[model samples]
Target: MLNLKQIVAGYGPAQVLHGVSLDVPRGRVSALLGANGAGKTTLMRVLAGLVRPQSGSVEHEGREITALPAPRRVGLGIAMSPEGRMVFPTLTVEENLQLGAIHARARRGYRERREEMYALFPRLAERRRQTAGSMSGGEQQMLAIARALMARPDVLLLDEPTLGLAPVMVKQIFEVVQRLKEGGLTMFIAEQNVRQTLEIADHAYVLENGRVQLEGSGAALINDAGVRRAYLGM
Candidate 1:
């Protein structure tokens, strides 16, 4: 559903991705794994239209969207839950989620989506009226993902979904991802949690030094010596 070719992008004079290429097919979870500074997040940013690529093309469903603005990308059903779980701290959980409904199509389904979000995340429902900053780290993470879901994206880019959460919360987030995958939502997941990512992913790409070094079935990459040595620390 998404194709990125020769994506050269970075912050101010330092190009991080050099000739990077990857494909994310429809109805599958594609895992992008890399240690820090591997251009994983940069790739997601480029896809989200937050950071324009220095030179490359990003196509969605065979339509060229590389030059489109970020809001247009969101309108095209692409949403990214960034690395830091960036939710509006002072806003109530409902308010934060409401912010994600900026897409014209999404706004039409706002009430239904809000209830769906509450159902998908009961914890958020319990504190829907509470301020986001008051929630625990895990709850905040949940709120972040929930808000992203409020956009009802076709291809959700999830970056570091399990970053600093406890094991239990990580498990919960992964479970939600698995459910989304089962529901046939195409996703590009950037995760440091290798074992779990491989377990749930259909295909995987290992990024290193700003390029994809290995791309294969998740199970295949999981058992590969290179991936095991570099990522799993096994």
Candidate 2:
């Protein structure tokens, strides 16, 4: 449902993504696997409209969205769960999620969507009034995902949702990802855990040195010689 073509982007003058082209087919989980500094996060931000591309095009469903601002992107059904969770530490979980629906177009039925988020994340229902910072890392990550879901997104961008979590938490988060996939959510996930990401994704792209090095079906990528040598460590 989303297509990025030659996405050249960076912070200020240092370009971090070079001709990074990939496609996220509708209702499928697309994983971008890479080590640190591979521009995975940069690519996610570009899709979210948080970072502008120097020269490239971003399209959703067939139309170009290269120049839309972040809110417009949200309005257009794109939501991001950032790498660090980025939950408002001072605010309650429900408040944080509610704030996410404040985009101009979402004011109507905001309360209804908030209830939907709580339903999707039952654990969030119990902790709705608790401060985000008081929650565990995994819970904070859930809050991030829940907050993004509050926007009622058609596509979700997940950036390192398992970073620094315990093994059990990682499994739980991946389970949530699986559930979302089964329920037909389109997602682009930038992840360090190649095995887990590949397991959940339909297709995968390997990013190296700020560019796409290889792309294929997730299972195929898991067995690729170069990917095994560098990423899977086989």
Candidate 3:
């Protein structure tokens, strides 16, 4: 499980998150829903240890990791697939995946784990030797998620995994998320596609202006009059 309490972070003088708090239960998908600039991405970065919080704390399974570095967080079973699907342009699909196994624990069974990833994403298997830059956006996004899985994380942080993808590709991505959830992966997804995200998420939190505005079960939030009106356009 992951927990954040009163996390305040910012870039220099421009503060983004203000007294944000949330919990991610083990083996469940927790969705963070917000429009742009709501500090969703910043929250993700804070969890991943990329951005040090100015106040409060981040804990995983009761261990404080507020000051831990990014690599150490990855070693602690935290892996993040960032917003833009930032795959290596010149690296082959296989190489990109291999890069994710930087931690010793992940590298122990690298080959077998990679095969599992390939099985989960057959398309990547087909283009194992292809350069990442040559792949389509959907393919690249798949590669991005696959690469993160290569770290063999216990909790995966996905920031806008479906951003800018085609509707069909978005559906495919969500299906993958659903499968991960079924397999008992603990995930914290920051997404804008409210309807689909709530469908697959166990719990949901709505962020507005860098703070939690609402938090509830996925279905409850989906059926909420305000959520329906603002996010679902109903």
Candidate 4:
């Protein structure tokens, strides 16, 4: 489980997140839903230790990690599959995954973890020696998620996993998420794709202007009149 309390973060002087607070329960999917510029990515970055909060705390299973660096967070069993599927374009799929396990904490069972990733996304196994740049967007997204899993993280942060893909690919990505959920992976996701995201999320927070505008169970949000009107356009 991870807890972020009153997180205040921003780039340089202009603040982006304003006292944002949320929780990611163990073995459950927590979603952050909002339009662009709603501070969703910023919040994820803070949790990943890429962006340190100006004020507040980040606790992983009751261990405060607010000041830890990104690599330290990875060592602490937190992994992030960034938005836009930022795979190493020039590296082979295997090579990219290898880098993910470079940290000492993830190195011990590297082979086993790699194999698990392959099993989760067989396309990755087929393209083990292929350059990442040559893969399709959907394949690249899968590669990104697989690469993160190589670290054997306890909590996974996914930022816009379905950003710019075909509808079919989106469904595949969601399926992967469902599978991860069933496997008891603690995931915190930031997404613009509301309907599908809420369907899979156990709990969700709706963000607006660097703050939580609403927070509730995903199923409840699905039937929420305001959520339907604003994000789903129902």
Candidate 5:
């Protein structure tokens, strides 16, 4: 559903992505795997229209969106939960979620979507009035993802969604990812949790030095000799 072709992006003169290209199929989870500074997050930023690529194009469905701004991208069915779970700390959980539906399209049935989010994350339901800053790390992560889904995005961009959560919390978050996949939500996840990411992703790509070094079905990557040695430590 989303296609990025020969993308070259960076900060000022320091280029980070060097001709990166990938596809995210509709209703499937596509994992972008890489070590730190591999440009995974940069690619996500490009797709979300937060970073303008110097060259190459971002196409959703069949139209180019490379020139679109961040807010326009959100209106066009793209939403991102950034790397740090940048939730508004001072805002209540419900208020944070409400902000996600600010786009006119998402505003339709906003109340219903809020209820759905509460159902998806029962903890948030219980703490709807609690300040986001007061929530635990795991709860915060849930709130982050829940907030993104409130926009009813056609494709969700998740950058390091499980970054620093405990093992149990990581498992819980992945379960939610699985549930979203089952619900036919198209997602592009940039993650470092190799094993868990591959287990849940339909397809996966490994990035090295801002380039795609490997691409394959997630199960195949799981059993790949190189992937096992490098990522799985097997």
Candidate 6:
């Protein structure tokens, strides 16, 4: 339900994405796979309205939103859980969730939504009053995703959700993503973990040097010689 066309974006004069284009169909998981500096994160930022594109357009459902501000995009059902799990260290778990629902639309059923998030993440429920800073990296990542879900977004942008986490944690995080997919959440995930990502992705794109190098159905790409050689070492 989201589309990007020839999107060129960057910070200052260093352009990262060179006319990158992709589509995220409704109720499907779209994976953007690349190693470091492939413009994966930049593209996610552009989609989230955190970075204004120098050219091209971003359309959601059918409406152009390239010029819209980040907060406005959030109001339009776009929520991003950034790369670093940037949670408020000083805030309690529940408080961070409260901040996520600050927007009027999300605030409508805050209590019920919080409970839903808690159900999705029982660990958070147990540590509801604990400060975010003291949590483990895995727990922090869970909090980041949970906080974004608090907004009740239509499409969730998950950027490197498993970055730097333990192997077990990575598995858990992917399981959570799988559950979200089963529940019909439209997601655009930027990740380096190819195997697990492709396992759940409906469509996948391989990005390199700020452009799409390959795009195909997840199942198709998984067996692709190029993909296996380059990423899976098959």
lDDT of 6 by residue, 1-234 (tens): 899999999999999999998999999999999979999999999999988999999999989999999998889999999999999999999999999999877999999999999999999999999999999999999999999999999999999999999999999999999999999999999988899999999999999999999999999999999999999989
Candidate 2 clash figure, as a count: 0
Candidate 4, residue 92: Cα displacement in angstroms equals 0.3
RMSD of 5: 0.7
Q: Mind giving the per-residue lDDT tens digits that candidate 5 earns over 1-234?
A: 899999999999999999999999999999999889999999999999999999999998889989999999898889999999999999999999999899987999999999999998999999999999999999999999999998999999999999999999999899999999999999999998999999999999999999999999999999999999999999
Question: What is the number of residue pairs that collide in model 5?
Answer: 0
Task: Report the error of model 2 at residue 58, Å.
Answer: 0.9
lDDT of each: 0.92, 0.91, 0.95, 0.94, 0.94, 0.95
True-structure Cα RMSD, model 1: 0.8
Per-candidate TM equals 0.98, 0.96, 0.99, 0.98, 0.99, 0.99
Runs in model 5 lying further than 4 Å from the true structure: none
Worst 10 residues of 6 by lDDT: 99-108
lDDT (Cα, tens digit) per residue for candidate 3, span 103-142:
8869999999999999988999999999999999999999
lDDT for residue 65 in candidate 3, whole number 0-100 = 89
Give a tens-digit lDDT track for model 1, residues 169-221: 99999999999998999999999999999999999999999988999999999
Candidate 6 error regions (>4 Å):
none
| Candidate 3 clashing pairs, residues 3+ apart or interchain | none
Q: Rate residue 225 of model 5 by lDDT.
A: 98
In model 3, how many backbone clashes occur?
Answer: 0
Positional deviation of 190 in candidate 3, in angstroms? 0.7
lDDT over C-alpha atoms for residue 89 of model 2 = 99
Candidate 5 lDDT score at position 196: 92
Question: For model 2, what is the C-alpha lDDT against the true structure?
Answer: 0.91
